[model samples]
Target: MVHHRPRTRERCPLWARRARASTPLRTLLLGLLLTLAAGPISMGATDGGGIGGTGITGFGPIQGFGSIFVNAREYFLRADTRITVDGRAAGRRALHVGDMVVVRGTADPARTTGWADVVQVRHPLVGRVDAVSAGGAHLTVLGQGVRIPAGVPVVGGDGHTVALHAGDWVAVSALANARDEWIATRVALRYPAGSVPAGVPAVIEGRVASVGPNGVLRIGTQAVRLEGAAAHKSAPAPGARIRVVGRYRDGVILASRLAPARPALGGPGRYVEMEGYAVPRAAGGLHSNGILLRPPGGKEGAGPTGIRADRALVFTGRIGPDGSLEIERMEPPHAPELPHAGAGGGERGFGGHGTHGIERPELERPRIERPELEQPRIERPEIGRPRIERPEIVRPEIEIPQAQRPEIPEVEMPGH
Candidate 1:
């Protein structure tokens, strides 16, 4: 029976024992408090927003290159923001003016200014080349300078580098640089820059080059044939800048209606601004509202209004030689297309559908059948008074009582 007694609970001071047990918990709580004192981990946020936070969004045409402008405000690009054009990944410099864009970003405290976290280009500019540099590093379109950096994708009808030239119409996809210059990423030719396709009506703006063997109006070697067209029964004088709408064939565009070009007119150092609907890319190449812009002095080669010698060639008339005038401040064509006329719509030409050209809506008359009228009828409820019947009552005979009253009455009557 030499079993050792069960070991009793250890005899220790209460506070000391409790402290020993809580050592781990106190250390953990102290570490947690220290962590709480430290602030959140930092990431770059120039406009005071985190990468995961809700951001602002906007939709409009790109107002400039380098930085995107939408809804009349400018947004600079961010490093982590996604940029896409026609569903393709693109850099900030790949954005171009007049290309419709949707942007998401975080606004600064003012909200007027902000940084763009994402941008998407919906459409590219389709137009004719105003000018091209000798080395092909730069070109002009609708008075806007486009820098063709290396690695740019240039696709011709034959597929790749079709040897760009002045007077050639082209469709450009580009981005903006830090300098705000349009850095073209894709220069696709719908046709030879200046030549129009056969059998399609288009609006053209240029000087009449010459008249050919048949009745033809030449717009810089691009002839104008007066066949199957309207309002062109008469011939336009040579060297006249006119807006002609008709089908194009064999470098000749059949003139339907020829009118004097209403260019944004200006003299040297003068500013001109014109706003109009963007013509279809399929028909009108870089001819915004059928406007033809010549050089400042009305001469293209001798213009001294561009930034570079070649860049100078882009500004319509004589404003190009020295490249002095910077008139190609493109505005966004962000007006939405309306379901009905004049509600809210895309660029409507002067005096017509918010879109381009002379279009007449078809009139239709609706035939409605008249419904027949029903005869009037009055309805009344039948109400009549109810009749009640009464029951007859009979009394028992009283002969003796009646006789006694008669005797007394007779005696009194005799005495009277």
Candidate 2:
């Protein structure tokens, strides 16, 4: 027979000969090693994860322009990208650096670059300044207390860093600490870059404290009037956060636009990444940027202990079907250092959001002591000068001719 004999191990390739000589366990181990080497590649393609993956959403301050950067991801704004400011449709020009924004988009598997589908800029507080602290480091606006940490950029209508004052209408972009105190990142005056424009509307965003049946909604201490709104259809319930854009007249705002506030986290099932101060909830889990976070394997209503409140944290997760965040991974906490007074100027004002590294200064209040003193007893001068009896001098009266009194006209100032 001309059939070739089975190939002998000696004549076979070196790889075949070695495979024939290897034990079953060694062969299994070799196959496992190869699979492990290629695992990342196959997994990356299927799950869009593992070394490289898509970025779905992010929330943070806009780091720079060109294409908005948030949470360390650059989201390029395309022609169809929808942009909004304070719940009103706006152009990209309305966006500025240091503005806290939520970006929703699709990123390449590498996660280096992304295309933004929606960019929303929502200010934390927008209302008339109720009060400014003595040093301008703290303010009360629309019934909410705001702290202007040193180095936080305070800008005026002219777009320059300036001191905030009482009664000044402002838009505040900020972060909420665990104490529910707002730490302002940017405070911009809303009036008069030099002069107030006619019919310009003011914007207010806050939780609706109460909703009246008479079409009046109160957010903080300010009342909003919704004209032509159905009781159940357009009115937001109490405790619902919302944005109102309108003119402020008397003590009520005539809302021209009203809508539910956009949250930092996007729709359900959306993958999201955000950097924010974590505030543990009373019920359970952690809350950040308006989203509740439940750690992996955590059961509902079962709180995670040892969670630090107001500690800045970067979280990666997906939005649950109920809108809560399902945390897949949480990085170590990163707290933003409290700003201290810089050496540049004695007066602290908004410094243009430069984000200079500042050390937290020792906040010791120096004690001042006042020396108690006794009032000196001074005896009334006994020598009251004898009142010289001055003889009453007769006064002469004169009559003047009347030129017809010129009529003064009352001028009415223009109303806003």
Candidate 3:
């Protein structure tokens, strides 16, 4: 059973001004006192857990009191140590073994564990992936209630399902029993790309020109295909700029629905690299963005701060009209080196780069050429434990005379 909730936001008040007013002398004195006595501060949840609170905006586990959690929908501040700590801790903190936390915020129906302002982070799992099918080449994780397809959009580490090939290692969270199968709401691959940004699946606002009979919409010169039943109802007038959730499919984008036009951050000519799976190439050698990159193991509704690309490459151009990236260049990463062959033959003919003719000795020759050491000898039993008997020590009969011994000399100190 999945419970859907509304999103929340984070708010920061006049705490900045108060900190700025305090001078170095006062700050130093305060620091000294804090060092001597460690106790919780009583400020709002935006001042770094000081007398005020702290902002939990970035990654990593956050520690401290009075934390603030923010996202697109809303902001929230709670007294709970985990909530007050940071966003990353929401899972570990809110979802303890048996703790129950109530959440009130906007819910994303499409994804399980999607991002929310997180009014509350409590025990048990929240969210779900509606349908599961086998022909989609998807893998049904019997433990997490998730059916991750072969080429789903994912952000590595951020906790989203990335493209999966045979033998790929992945981490699964919130495994539940759904029928006879185990379902995982969160599925992540072991190898993930770097950080992804917030508000990705970012809104690309543009004009809507034509809606074909097939429900393919055109914005400017670009044409977009829509999925689900929402496509037909969301059609817009030709040349009408609109915004749509750029749900990517196979490297290319198919706009889900029409939305109001809005300004977008990170524009054309900005050199950026996004890692995702590569959908099969289209008729014109173009491929769809099939990457399911997120932070290594991200949940749904979470901002995409990372990605897992099927093929790693650099995107030098702007995002195209269809929401597909216009790739200026593609680069495949170099593979690791293999073990070498014998001396000359190994270095020269490795990777099929060089050819060694008949002059060089073949590698098939026996490793040991000399047969003299091959003959085995009879074994001899050891006396006791193979002890090495030392030769008898011979002592000289005469001892050294006292007169022959050198006399000792004493040196005096400066004071003496």
Task: Give me the runs in candidate 2 sitting further than 4 Å from their true place.
Answer: 1-55, 108-112, 192-199, 230-240, 256-264, 303-305, 332-416
Candidate 1 residues 322-398, lDDT tens each? 32333344433332222232443333111121221111222356788899999789888798878878877788887
Q: Top model by TM-score, which number? A: 2
Pick by lDDT: which candidate is best? 2
lDDT of 3 by residue, 132-233 (tens): 356423443211234332222233343333555433333332211212122222344443222222222312334466778777776534445766645756
Worst ten in a row by lDDT for model 3: 348-357
State how far residue 215 of model 2 sits from its true place (Å).
Answer: 2.4
Quality of model 1 by C-alpha lDDT: 0.49
TM-score of each prediction = 0.28, 0.62, 0.21
Cα TM-score of candidate 2 = 0.62
lDDT values, one for every candidate: 0.49, 0.67, 0.33
